[model samples]
Target: MHPKRKLTTVIAVGVAPLIAVSLPADTADAHGWVTSPASRQDQCFAGTVACGPIKWEPDAVEGPKGLKNCSGGNAQFADLDDDRKGWQVHDVNASETFTWQLTAQHSTSTWQYFVGNQKVAEFDQGGAQPPQFVKHRVNFGSVRGRQKVLAVWNIADTDNAFYACIDVNVRG
Candidate 1:
């Protein structure tokens, strides 16, 4: 083989595979979600919930500016928005402490929980940095039976938030 042809062949064989197999940039943030009672992301990461890329990066459910959907406004995480997914329901009393396991601690403004359209609880951080584990004692009030809770973690510096949807049976 000619010198140029041999070099060209080597370059094509080595570089082409790398280009073809390369993934997108690492846009994953190290934020987190509820894990004690098992949030949807927790289930996905634990192989209980069938999910997409989120199964690999459970702590990366950051959303667009000011959008507080069940899936953190990310279509990749849309499985969390579905209530009929047969998610494992954790049984809890009216008042219970829910914990968020943070992979990367970010300055937070507040954490809020909602049942349907009604706000059930809020924990204000007041733009302070949080610990690796942030706990909130939430009360479901008069709610009973199977319920989906939407949890939001508002980042203080940015306009985005982390979201987690947890299915639970509210036992009186």
Candidate 2:
């Protein structure tokens, strides 16, 4: 085989995986947020087994994510690109462990957040097509903070059980 041809093939083989990594996957947005809930009647329920909404003071506007520009539907959905209040959490705890839930009308889910709620992340789910409902999990990331940690849940979707209500749960 030609030297250049062999080298080209070798390079292609090595770079093929890298290219694939860069490319987004088809199921990428499979289980992600959607506009399923038309209004508050859709779903509602969060926190540690009916204690009330996850109470937490806005530590700070550390982030400006989600659909802050758009309007209608669930405020959480509207908060797609940015937070409605443009609030960012701050002074989160570094060491904490708990398993809470974010249940909705159509589906119910739970999460185990640890290392504080500093940079908490969520995992959303979409169905066969885009514009699916939200199914998020995770405590943001391992980014822990030390100070007056104030954790909270936006309660985007609603659960029929306790629809129109929101709550938060924490354990250590």
Best by lDDT: 1
Angstrom error at residue 28, model 2: 4.6
The C-alpha local distance difference test score for the whole of candidate 2 amounts to 0.28
Candidate 1: residue 54 lDDT (0-100): 80
lDDT of 2 at 27: 46
Query: Which window of 10 residues has the lowest lDDT sum in candidate 2?
Result: 52-61
Error of 2 at 144 (Å): 44
> Candidate 2 on 62-135: residue-level lDDT in tens?
12222112222234333222222323222223333322222222242322122233335433322122122233
How much RMSD separates candidate 1 from the native structure?
Answer: 6.0
Residue 1, candidate 2: Cα error in Å is 1.6
